[model samples]
Target: HPLFPLLALLFEKCELATQSSECPSTESFNLDIQAFVQHQDRERKPFFTEDHEVNDLMIKAIQVLRIHMLELEKVQELCKDFCNRYITCLKGKMQSENLLRSDYGGYDSDDSSSGAGSAAGLPGIPPPGMPGGRHSVPPGLIGGPPVPPYYGHPGPGPHHLS
Candidate 1:
């Protein structure tokens, strides 16, 4: 639940970038349309026109198409870059969450240890009940003497407290 806002923001940014990149610039579109219309108009003209004029019209049309093609390629590149960044962001978030869980003694749901000292497997650490481990006995109590249970009297009997 806490990650909702961050994920929402990320998605929003991705959507905005995609929309902006996918939509061709209005000015560029208008220019392309104008060039195409002029080319068509030139073709409809009288056949008596000079050969050089027809060649110039053909060249202009080719140039306009090339420009449109380049713009499409640029938009495609932007989309690819955006997708890569989004995937990286998601990976970073997942790694951070795992680190937080480990720090707080939370084990992965798939782990078989059931929240025991999973750190025991790591280097420079000891296992449970071993020396310097989480469940290890203090040095002073290690094999020193046997502790006797007190019955509140020398002989074993139910004694009343006065």
Candidate 2:
């Protein structure tokens, strides 16, 4: 009995690296992929395995694949939603700018009253006291001058009638 114990101890040198261990981080991802493949191969050997074992393995594989597909779908949906929101916001800004420009002095090419552009009805950026620029009639009133501070100021009121 003492010799048998001594013989077992001599042959029992354990290895730190074995099939059972915590998976490494993504930096060592190739090792994990190889392990997954090896695990699959080993689990499939012993051809006469019970039907229940085969069923269990198949179910596990299906679950992994399903999870991956669901994650990909979520990413796609997020991207689509972001794109739609971005486009809508851009259109709103552009429409507001067009309304502001059409009101300020750049109107249709049919008015034959003033050629100086400013002489027609374009507002000279009226003083701060006037909100609507021309007696509260509102800018771009078909004959009123264009509103002033055209560059950065938010026009009084909504500016967009549409």
Candidate 3:
């Protein structure tokens, strides 16, 4: 569990940020990263395996974290960004697994639906006015309308856009 410390730090920071509705400074995060790096160097063991898909997702997550650290340096926002990215990653992973299962004729309807629901529900989206606060938009959607589930889709119901 070489990554345990880093993951714990991320969860703790994200919880605090969500609870307080404020981003914390990046000082502690930086320190934790440095510590993690030093530990990895000392251990001199391979951290990543040959699982390319999982490896790619991990790389993407790290890149997203690094970008936020450099640009925002706000723990709260960083956590939000990271969490959103993470949800995307989970969705991708689930989709891939479903594809594999389908190919093998082992697809499980229960698993796929539950996986999708879990990923979707994890964010517990904030309301519109809470943008950049508890209800902040994902970074890519900043300055844009709040992205409701049906944002771009036309519907047949009363909620349909004109």
TM-score of each: 0.33, 0.32, 0.35
TM-score of 3: 0.35
Best by lDDT: 3
List residue ranges in candidate 2 displaced over 4 A.
1-58, 106-162
Q: Which ten residues in a row have the lowest lDDT in candidate 1?
A: 1-10
* Model 1 alpha-carbon drift over 4 Å, by segment: 1-54, 105-162
lDDT for each residue of candidate 3 in 1-162, tens digit (9 for 90 to 100) = 445456667656655645675655667667777877888889895657677777676656655665554444455566889999999999999998877666644532233332332222323433233533443434324464454455676424346444
Give the alpha-carbon lDDT of every model. Answer: 0.53, 0.46, 0.58
Residue pairs with colliding backbones in model 3 are: 132-136
Give the Å error, residue 30, model 1.
Answer: 24
A best-first ranking of the candidates according to their TM-score comes to: 3, 1, 2
Residue runs of model 3 more than 4 Å from their true location after superposition: 1-5, 65-162
lDDT of 1 by residue, 1-162 (tens): 222232343334344544665644435544654654576568664322356666566556545544654566577788789999999999999998778677654542323344333442343555566567767874334565534445553332234233
